[model samples]
Target: MIEIMRTMVSYLGSDHKHTALSGGDHLTCEREQGAKRHVQCSNTPGGRIEQLEPCIDGWHCVMNFMILIWQKLHKDSQEDYGTLSSLFARIGCSKAKKPKNDMHTCQAAFLKVFKGHIVTAGCKEFDIEGHKEVNQSLLSSVAQTVVKEFTVIPEALLGESVIDSGDKVHGYARVLCHFASLVLLFVDAWKEGDGERVIRLWKILMLHFHAEKKTKYALEALRLQFQLATLQPYLSHQLTWGRFINTHGGLGRNIPCDLHNEHINKLYKNIISNMGANFTKTASTWAARSVSSLHRISMAFDSPWPLTSRLTSTVKQQLTARGQMRRTSRQL
Candidate 1:
């Protein structure tokens, strides 16, 4: 794996082909210092290993590795648990397939890859047919390594003080919600067009996302939500009736406030209700940014803002009218 990663970096690292005319007849090789800096190190299961040994573009390498890992994991999953009750029997629950709490499969895979032991709680003996002992052991070892490298740090969660606990919980809820939204989007994209590759990407992305959330993965989940929103309509339509999306991006006319405005409004309500008076401006701003980004992306797919000024005027007028009605009612 190290050799493979190094070879990839060698091919991607240099800008030797780039040349600039320094004089009338002389062509001097020019290098892109920024690109060189951008890919200085690679993030791997082993952590940041070596920086001087040909800088491995961390983002690119990780992305590529994620693609590879997802492919391998997906293929392994299909082979192991693609059947109906087969998966439930192995993982002990149907919900294990959920991208957020894939503890079962993750545990299994971690064990398989690193520990070399598959711990089965209980299942019909028939379900274990053709299970080679050797393969199971190998997979368990790999799984152990993965679990150690990526599992969340419980200490961090426990360290939050009572006064600021809401922030931590809100952050968690936001991440899970955003993750569900993105997974749904990927599913929707696959349902729409050209989603096979996207679906395959979920495994690695989920792993990395979860790993980051453990200690230092702030806002990655939110950022991913933005990226996914712009790419495909995960939260495009109401997942159910009476659902609404939120207005996102900038305040502009002609942006129909996103088809999913109802959902966003619902989310806002839930967030408010849950957090109550404790909701901070930071949380509000985070939610607002979500709405704004969605609106901006939604608008891009439709008409340019021609009615923004008109809409703003109407909203202000309505609010003013409502205020007057309340004042009159109070006086009465």
Candidate 2:
């Protein structure tokens, strides 16, 4: 998802020179340091990167997508860019002088911004009109807020008729909303353990990739399709190792292999940071072991509490409301 999002931003944004396809065959994009890189874009059999790497968290995918959209708008939109900049600022994401060139700044800003959007029991709706408090933590809520806020840019620029506008910026915003909606639906299906629905939505997402193939983003589209093809089997069968736990007591569904690895990496980083940057490797290992033990102990103690149930119910209600809004919007 990160790779796909990065490719999309690079290809779709105003930086055309960086992502030129070579020989109309393979995918080639210039790296940050101006070096040419080639990526296999064919449908032929190859090693899937996800198979070897950790699954990126769904939130990370959405975050990257949101940041990419912001970057795109910063580059392309002139009249309404300030609106987005102000909206981001409301969430503590300060506007950078050069949003397109300073990706690190954009990323850092959104990370802080997302910290407030992390799923929690007291999540609140994001009101664009009043710039209301955004305290939601559910993945769906974040996606919904992203769609609403991003849709504002085009709407502000092209008015209520923005949806009918043939402008490039409008198209990008619409694509962003569509992608976010699909991802939220995918997450809902995955949480519900609905493998069929997951596969269906994934195919729909692949269709978007297919649509991009005829455009300037053809190489990126092809490369994305190739990289994500491996997940089809796992999505279809829902039987891929310990990651796909059938027991409802354990995460309620299959946790992607990457989530676990990423969580551990995050935990390790947090632990190291807390250790004040001068700890020995052995000390860090022991500290990590202790933290793990304490975490298990705390979970065991909290298992009997009703807080978990309440939080779950809250999340469900939020998701249901968001789903209804999506359905209503589609019908209209």
Candidate 3:
């Protein structure tokens, strides 16, 4: 059986030159003399085996071979008749002096070959339309088997298997499906008023992904939580604003300042507000501190200036500190 399967797979895998042997709606028996000559005698005393010529239409032979194999393996019901009938009707003629027309015999021959290959098997006939139903059932069974295999990994991992990059991307898709399912469960819990269960699932999700990827998955998982209203407090706080700022580069600077352009100022104000920061106050404080530090640093650099002399000793020390800060900031 394995050898037969291997041979079939090889044929299916290859598209190279090979003789086509079609027994379409007709089977032909070879004359024993010619058959023996072709099979055994490559070069007789005269030359290559005589009277062995290629078929008139060889593609017919190849199609017949494929259909015949499919029919014998899968076509057993009355339903299959519709599918295989046309092929069955085109059986080849016998390969002999008086070649006989016997398409049914050819179909039977194909079935016999297939049956012999797999096991002691017999065709269990069924109605033609039933073939589609049978096919659907077979597909369903295969799908179930694959899903069952996939479901085992989560259970085996104790619900902690955070899919790493080491896992296949297809497996990552499956993990995504699993996480999505968990999100659904959390949703159900919320719908049922099971607040604890919702929180529990959210925490599990966070912990699993957190431990796995060092918070790489945190934002995405939390985003899922937001939709469910199960995201933990401080998690939103933990949502690093750097992600947004870094995205904008220098424009990502969080410093707030009075802008002459209303559009630009409003845009900055909106962004800071949405990020849960006090835009006006935060910006003013930042700017004020920046100016103060600049003034002090300038005094520290050029001593005994008119404004520098009036500044207090404490202010002078602040200027020295600010000068150091300016130098450090520039280096950065």
Candidate 4:
């Protein structure tokens, strides 16, 4: 999985080409900081890779990379930055200035923060900014805000009257239904996927997403809406999906969850913020911090990405299911 992910990253960055960087008579360390030494980097990709190994290893910056794509496509008339823009808040995809205590916050401003700052620092549209502009401190601030406000309102800006309510509701339902469909697709890829429980969860999400899409809604005719509401735990965690509560429902399958990786990234960024120092000078400190922040377990690098961390919160319902099973057996 990691290798596949790496391949995608390389492809996205156009780093797949292995070209000779430079042939030098000697290698020399330019500066010494603590036990780490900095070497002069040549203009070639190989030279840059060697120079950047300290910052890049063990950490994934795919989201930021995707933002680069989004920014380019957003400005260009040819691409579908429209759909991506719709995924974010205020059409700017930047963080909301106020606390998202209400309905209007989608919290999708992570890329916005960097894009805004980098642009402020002279990164023009479709122009790649220098690595120097990738400010750790700025990123750390934006990371926390994005996590805090990161949201997706499945239903937003629906019609006012009940006559047109179902249109928006059903539309939002379709959006969520499509997501469930994708999950089912990957579940097939994984093989031996537990379809029944997942199907139930999806139906529940679909129903809620539809209902939420309306200015006001009620299910007078449809069957099992009340039951599904009772069974569903999140009750729109996307609206309330802070770093604390977002991972609740996404861990059903045996495979690794995307939210698992995302939260780990958020945690890493939070630690970066709390450290309260520029990592530019102290980037060599990343490895030890990786042991503490990225892994966040005694097993550390031994365990896979999410198998351990997700088990605790995600499987509580399984225990509930088991207890219900025992009670059913006694009743029988």
Clashes per candidate (backbone, < 3 Å): 37, 4, 22, 1
lDDT of 1: 0.33
Q: Using lDDT, rank the candidates from best to worst.
A: 2, 3, 1, 4
Off by over 4 Å in 4: 1-179, 187-260, 277-280, 283-332
Candidate 3: regions farther than 4 A off: 1-147, 155-170, 213-332
RMSDs, each prediction?
25.6, 15.3, 38.7, 24.6
- lDDT (tens digit, per residue) of candidate 3 on 155-240: 46554553434545234334433433454454345334344554456456556556545352344345444533542343322221
TM-score for each prediction?
Answer: 0.18, 0.38, 0.20, 0.22
| The candidate that achieves the highest TM-score relative to the unseen native structure | 2
* Decreasing TM-score order of the candidates: 2, 4, 3, 1
In the predicted model 2, the residue pairs found to clash are: 55-258, 118-137, 119-137, 119-138
Candidate 1 vs candidate 4: the lDDT winner is 1
lDDT (Cα, 0-100) at 141 in candidate 4: 62
Provide the overall lDDT of each model, using Cα atoms, as 2-decimal numbers: 0.33, 0.41, 0.34, 0.32
Tens digit per residue, CA lDDT, model 4, 1-332: 22322332353355534321111111111111111222234465433333121111000112222222333323323132223233232233333332222112322243333233323223222234332355655666654333222212223332232232344423332333233333334344223334344334434444543544421111211222343344234332211121122223454334323324544556666656666555553553473358344554645557565664445454322223233323222221
**Model 2 residue 114 lDDT score:** 28
Alpha carbon deviation, residue 276, candidate 3 (Å): 20
* Reference-based TM-score, model 4: 0.22
Q: Please, what are the lDDT tens digits per residue for candidate 1 over residues 214-304?
A: 2212233233334445532432221111121223333221111122343466666655666667789787757655764655566686777
